[model samples]
Target: METALTLQRTRSLRWRWLWLTPPVLFAALIAGTAIGETSISMDTVLKVLANQLLGADYAVDRIDAGIIWNYRLSRAIVAASCGAGLALAGVVLQALLRNPLADPYLMGISAGASTGAVGVTVAGIGAGAFSLSAGAFAGAGLAFGLVVLLAQAAGGGSCNGRSAQASGAIILAGIAGSQLFNALTAFIIARSASAEQARSIMFWLLGNLSGVRWDDVVLAVPVSLAGLLVCLWHRRALDVFTFGADSAASMGIAVRPVRGILIACVALVTAVMVSMVGAIGFVGLVIPHAMRFIVGSRHTRLVPASALAGAVFLIGSDILSRILVPGQVLPIGVITSLIGAPTFALIMIRGMRAR
Candidate 1:
């Protein structure tokens, strides 16, 4: 009876988090934009957002307006979008693969993107329309195609009395693809690259927000929304996956196609995101797992909660990266790793104890 009561209490708290998540996340977003060197107050952020959101044309100082609208706000939007996108992707993969440690990088997009970016930098490729982002996207697509071909060619697409996660074919294929692309990237970096180029590649891999702008903000917002919607739309299929393939098949769910669609969604979103901001890690890996404790394992609740929590987590991490030093913007990836690694350890311990 006591254990049951505790579970009920936990469930109630999780539902409360579901309601409170958006407000908290938006607050963090606003805080991230407002807390920079030339601090824009919360009131100013509200006014700016209100004017734009409501088309009210509220009066504000030109300097403050420029700072809020042009730079800080744009950066915050991009950060939040990337966070939410990556988190949603992570949720889908973990559910699809039934692996708690699964992340956006598991699909080989991160490695492919890094390779593309590195090649573009080192080889001076893409003199015309072949830009860095384009290269990254192309490379990610190539990696995705290869993984799909390999995984689906045999047992990855369909399950024959074995769980998808246990089959390990998709995971193995992804690892192979990642290794191949990473080796290509390393070779490019090792051969004839200057110190400046090497440093640029390193920063890109670690993820810097210095290049973020309204473009990323505009592109990422819709992509994030679309990806989240897709995931939520397919939540039932993901939940069915928890019961293993035979059960899911018995329930009339096409496990193979559903898995494909879910993974494709993750890959597409990750490619679009990482190509813009480099591979921002842990937002996806950590947010969903953390949220599961609060919201339980239902993707309906888990997806939305993870998205909001991810936005907050990344925005807060971005703020820390900005303020960690006087003038330097530290890599967002490093901050996430520092925060996520400890969080992962704690969760693992809790999970083991529960078991």
Candidate 2:
């Protein structure tokens, strides 16, 4: 009875905190918009948002309005969308693969996307026709396909039965695929890129958000929403996946089809985000783990918690990237790596202690 009561209390507390998530996410987005190199007041930010979003005319400085609407707001929205999408992808992969360290980029999607973008930019792969994003999407698909084939060849053909071995095989395949694509990207840079082109590719590979605009927001927002909906729809299946695939199959889950759909969803969402912002790491890997601690292990709570926390965390990270080194913008990936590396270490230490 005491254990049951304790569990009930925990659930109630998690739900209570969940209600606060959306407001906190909104505030974080607003703060991201307001605290750039040229600080715009929150009031001005609100007025600009109102003017642009709600068709309300408030007397805001034209330059501030333009910066808030065109630059910062769009960047924040895209950052949030990317964060949510990556986090959801992480949650899905970790759950389905039964691996604590699984992430959106585990399938070599980022490396593949990078290679494609570089091929287009440096090697002229598309003869000046395909956009970088198209190249990236294509490359990501190719890489994922290769990783899947490699995993299957290595006896991971099914994500059921001997799940641990299957998971390990897939992880190894992903690493190999990532390394191959990364090498291809480097080779293209070495052989074909001028200093200027190499510099641009390097910046983008570190995750650049300076180029994000309203057009990106259009693509990112819907993708994130769709990813979240799909994950949530499979929340129960994810919960059962904690016990491995055979257990999930015993529970009436169509483990193979479900796994395929979720993995494909993650691949598509992750590729789009990488194509748009380069490769931002750790958001996917860290955010889901962090949310599990806060909201408990239940996917019903964990899914949305991970999404909201990831969105807020990225917005905050983006804000820091802009202001951390005054007069110069750092790649958002650098900021995340700085934060994620230490946080991940601490999480590992705690996990060891708990065990």
Candidate 3:
């Protein structure tokens, strides 16, 4: 009877988390919108959102309203979307590959994006026609394509059996692809970019949200939702993947097709994010591992927990970037690394101790 009561109580708490998460996420978004260079109050933030979103008449200051609605709100939304997408991608990759260290960038999408952006900016490949985002997206696709081909050539596609071999092949292929694209980016930067161009490219490569707008919000939110839906749809498969691919196949999972679809989804989501905001690392890598600690290993619980945690983490990181230094906004990536690196180390230590 006591055991039954404990189990029921535990389930009740889990359900409470589900009920509480959305409100917490909303509050985090509001907090992100309110805290910035000018320190707009939460009351004003809510008034601005109500005025714009619900067409309510709130006599907020014009400048504050413009800053809230036009700049900070949109930025917050995109940050949330990117964070959720990247975290979801990480969860998928880690599950599929059965590697705790696996992340969205494991497929070389970020490297390809950097290469593409540099090719457009420094090599003049687009001749003033292509935007940096376009170039980055194209580069990401090209790089992922090459990585897929390399993985196939190295026997990653033979999912009739030998799932572990296929996973290893893909990881190796991704590493090679990343090295190649990163070299290409560096070469382009070295060969043609002047100091100013190099500085701009470097700044962008480190990640920037200074340029995000409603248009980006449109792209990010839909892609993030789509990615989350796709991952959640495959949550069962992902849970199975935690075992070896052979174990998943033995359980009647179509290991090859499922792997391909999920990986392609991850690549698409990562490419879109990299194009929009440059490569922000560690959110994907750290957030999933951290969520696993809190939510356990079930994909049903793990996936959304990771997404929410990731969104809030990035929003908080963006906030810190804005205010960490007087009169200067750091690259969001720098702030994440500063936080993620130490947190990751602690996680590793905990894992080692647990083992």
Candidate 4:
């Protein structure tokens, strides 16, 4: 009884803590604009942001409003959208696969994206008019379809037949898919028609947002919103599946159809993000796992917490990427793996000990 009371108190505290997320996210967004080669003041940044939002005639000095709105703001929005999408996809994948280590990349989505992105550059698929994102989406869609087919084949296309072995099989399939795609991507990268095009492919693979435009956000946001809605709508079903397929079935959750839809939703969102960010590795893995540790396995709280945590995590990473070098910026992807790898190792150590 005392243990139950302790759990309840902890739950209440987490609820209260979640209330701080929006303001925290807003503060981080504001701060993200403050740091750069120029280093604008917080007050100036806030005032400019406010003027734009409030349509006030007040002029802010020292900061380029055009630079802020056209350049920095789009980068920040892209970072946030990427974060939210990665975390949400992570949560859904973990639940569906019933494995803490499961992530969007685990299904070969990243590999497929890399393949498509590379293909466009090497083959000159669209020649002068081709978009990198189009290649990425095609690769991601192909990978998602393949993974679903492989998982279904392994499980007889039904949850009742999904075993612990299915998880391992799916993971192996993803590994194979990744290898095939990476090899193809590497081949294309090696034989690029022009050095400039090759350099673009290299930078895209490194996953930096040095050239983010408002158009990138325009493309990412709608797809992200649709994916976010799918995640939230299926939150309860995900939680039910956590108790195992038999238990979820007992609870009246339709497993196979739901799983298919969720996978497709996550893949679409992930594809959009990867296409924009060039495969921001480990956001999907780290953010959801961290939220699960703090908020427990319940999806009701897990989904939002993952989103908030991911936003904060990516925003922080982006700032580090900018400041890590005096005159040069590191790719945000490198920053995430640098931080995520150690954190994930620690989590695994503690989780193993607890077990």
Candidate 5:
């Protein structure tokens, strides 16, 4: 049944049409850059992009150039980077844990980041992007460490070797960690914040890219690129996990250490992204799963497809968020959830039918 489904999906996703992804991404970026409180046309967007990015001689107005280059350009880049990073993290976690439902946030990383960002937001500690980012990264690390510690206590880590038992332990640990940290976060909010601050925290937690700038884009680019390279490097190891840990070990892969490394990498990349984008959902959870159906189960194909598709998906969502309501920018996360939830349902329906 799985084989038949794979074949069917593969036939539908022609290799030639795959070239459309780049152009689609470019178009989405252009559209996202142009659509805002001050609407710029596609031509001006392109002209600004060319002058700034390619050192072209095309003329552009200063106001439009500032808006496009400083604000929207960075926002668009960060959106695409965050989307790709989140999707990569999701793919890694799903492959490592052998669970289709796995996503970057399942291990309480998002909750931890929420706690950290809230703490910063409410603490009056410079409430800047860097401060919130620092807090979130620290919190994510804490959550990740706790999950790993508990998994080890339950003898679930692949420290010695990989086993189904270990994966179950990690998942259980993650659940426990999530509940505990979530409660802690609520406690922090209740104890430390006024109603307004709490409300602001909630909004931020839902994910807002409004404050994103070129600084964010600069920060995200290296991490996203590094994470993608790491995933690509280990794609073969990920592919063999479908056959089980022992099978992978027989093929000369160190399943346990590799798992640890990949999980850590995914967790950090995810934490960094959530720090910038606030806990945007669905891109990570849905894009990889959908891309898998299109590209087949091979990690090599899956990773690149997920990266590009995820980038396009988030950039497109950012555009929708702007246009969804005039003058009032909706949180990008909300838009993604609206789109993702439906796609997720559709995927489930198709999966069930296949089964």
Candidate 6:
């Protein structure tokens, strides 16, 4: 009865907290843009947004309008999407592998994605009017397939029956593949015959939101939405897996096939995101970990909470990117790595101590 009461209380709390998420996330995103050197008041920011959104289409000022619309707003959305995608991927990978440390990039997805993006940028894969996102998508697809194949090889073909040892082996293979892809990417960067080509490759690899448009948002939204739905639908299965494969199987879960499909879906979603935004890192790594404390590991709660947390984190980070230096903006990826790496290290150290 006490346990039941506790669960009820917890659910109540989550229900209340969930209501605050959207406003807080949206506020943070808008506020992040208001902090730069040409700092606009929140009132002005809101007004500009209201006017533009309400189809007034009149600039409070040309400068404020440009800063608010052309630059900061788009960047915020990109950051939020990247964050949400990464965190969702992280949760999916962790659950699929049944390991706290598993991430989408753990299986060399990023490296493969990077290779494809870099190859296109350097090799000039598209003709005039072609898009870099196409190459990025192709790269992400190839890399994702390779990781699954390598994991299967490590897992003795079925790859469905996951053991700690199998998980470890899969991780190692991913690392190796990532390293190989990174080396090739470096070679492409080095052999670039022109400064422009080299610069483009470097910027893309570094990750940025400089030229983001409605089109980028359009491409990313459907894929991200689909992936989120998949994650949510499989949440119960993920919770079951935490208990063990046998336990999950006993509960009628088809562990292997579900995991494979989830992984593929996450990869496809992530590949599209990376193709669009370059390789933004660590939102996945950080957000899910943080949300787990609030929501526990129940997929129903975890999936939505993690998505919100991720969106919050990345939007905040992107806002920081623009305002961090006057007249200079850093890549969203760099901000995430800078903030995420230290947080990750702390999580690692804490885990080691607990062990």
Compare the candidates by lDDT and give the number of the best one: 2
lDDT by residue for model 5 (206-293), tens: 7888888888988898889999999999999989876677878899998778877887788778778887878887777899889877
List model 4 lDDT by residue over 28-98, tens digit each.
77767777656776776767778888876657763477667767777887888889888898888778777
Least well predicted 10-residue stretch by lDDT in candidate 5: 10-19
For every model shown, what is its TM-score relative to the native structure?
0.86, 0.93, 0.89, 0.91, 0.86, 0.89
lDDT of each: 0.80, 0.87, 0.85, 0.79, 0.81, 0.76
- Residues 181-217 of candidate 2: C-alpha lDDT, one tens digit per residue: 9999999998999999889888988888999999999
Clashes of 5: 0
Give the residue spans of candidate 6 off by over 4 A: 1-4, 57-59, 126-131, 152-161, 244-247, 349-355
Tens-place lDDT per residue, model 6, 4-91, is 9998999888777667888988887887667665778887788788887886654488788888877777767766777778889999
**For model 3, how does the per-residue alpha-carbon lDDT over 25-120 read when each residue is reduced to its tens digit?**
898789889988888888898999899889999899999999998999999999999899989988998887776777756667778877887798
lDDT of 4 at 133: 73
Over 4 Å off, model 2: 126-131, 153-161
Please list all clashing residue pairs in model 6, or write none if there are none: 87-284
Runs of candidate 1 with Cα error greater than 4 angstroms are 1-10, 50-61, 117-134, 144-161, 164-176, 189-197
Ranking by lDDT: 2, 3, 5, 1, 4, 6
lDDT of 5 at 145: 83
Candidate with the greatest TM-score versus the true structure: 2
User: Between prediction 1 and prediction 2, which has the larger lDDT?
Assistant: 2
The ten-residue window of minimal lDDT in model 6 covers 154-163
- Report backbone clashes per prediction: 0, 0, 0, 0, 0, 1
Q: Write the per-residue lDDT of candidate 1 for residues 1-355, one digit (tens) a residue.
A: 9999998898889899899987897788789879876767788878888887788787888888878888888888888888898999888877766667667676677888777766675777676557766677677778767875777785566323256445477777778888888788878887858888778777877877777889788788998999999998988877877666677788998877877777667776787778777778778888888998889999889989888888888888889888888888899899999999899889889989999
